[model samples]
Target: MTGKSLADYQKEYERIIFFDQPKKDILLAGLKAEMEKQFKLPTRSKEWKNENQKVIAMYRKICITRML
Candidate 1:
């Protein structure tokens, strides 16, 4: 959990959403495509949805930590 509280995560998420608004679509599409390619999951399946959400959440946290 990155040793951070929920509030901290929320704040980071909001900050990123605001500052990265212009490139959000591009970032999301690229992340989704990368996940699809790496996992080879069926796009319409529930598993894909779950994994995608996990990837996005992780990505956001990583961004906050300056890992990406």
Candidate 2:
């Protein structure tokens, strides 16, 4: 994606995280899917990689693991 769009996505991500519109899982999954879907971009751009890693880490912290 272009730098402008990337910046816009980041801004949206921040708003969702702050105001809790997406509730974490949706945002992370959506972002990961978007990142994977756009894998044809040049290898030099690690932006998606960084974003996925961060969101995965955050998910791991709060997500429930064991079935009730």
Candidate 3:
């Protein structure tokens, strides 16, 4: 599979799940904050890599589930 950036997966998931502008903005901001916290480690660290993969997998699963 082609590699997708975290932002790309996030945007796709957001589009699939969030319809209201106000709620979407609020929720997305909160999610972003949490992700920022989780990603505090250096980009090349194992923990960071694991977190990134986990997030991408989550987004893909959520988007697929929502679409079904």
Candidate 4:
């Protein structure tokens, strides 16, 4: 986890989600907005950062499985 880069997961997630650049940007924006709304925390806050890391880990697992 420490060594794994967000860039790797991002590329994998994009591959799995199959969205074009524009749509992908929109989707990511919506996801971020929803997370901010649900958590009621600023994105820069430690809690939000931890929560986001968890979400990214889960998504990375799903992306790995999808790739296989």
Q: What CA root-mean-square deviation does each model show from the true structure?
A: 9.1, 7.6, 10.6, 10.6
| lDDT digits (tens) for residues 7-30 of candidate 4 | 654564556467765666566555
- Which has the greatest lDDT? 3
Off by over 4 Å in 2: 1-4, 19-22, 40-68
- TM per candidate: 0.35, 0.39, 0.37, 0.41
Give me the overall lDDT of model 4. 0.53
In every candidate, how many clashes are there? 0, 0, 0, 0
Off by over 4 Å in 3: 1-17, 41-68
lDDT of 1: 0.51
Clashing pairs in 4: none
lDDT (Cα, tens digit) per residue for candidate 1, span 1-68? 23444345455455555446557545544544444455453356776667567554655554554443
Decreasing lDDT order of the candidates: 3, 4, 1, 2
Please tell me which predicted candidate would have the highest TM-score against the true structure: 4
lDDT of 2 by residue, 1-68 (tens): 34334444456555555534356657655654554455433234567657566444433332331110
TM-score for candidate 1, please give it: 0.35
Error of 1 at 55 (Å): 6.6
- Residue 14's lDDT in candidate 1: 54
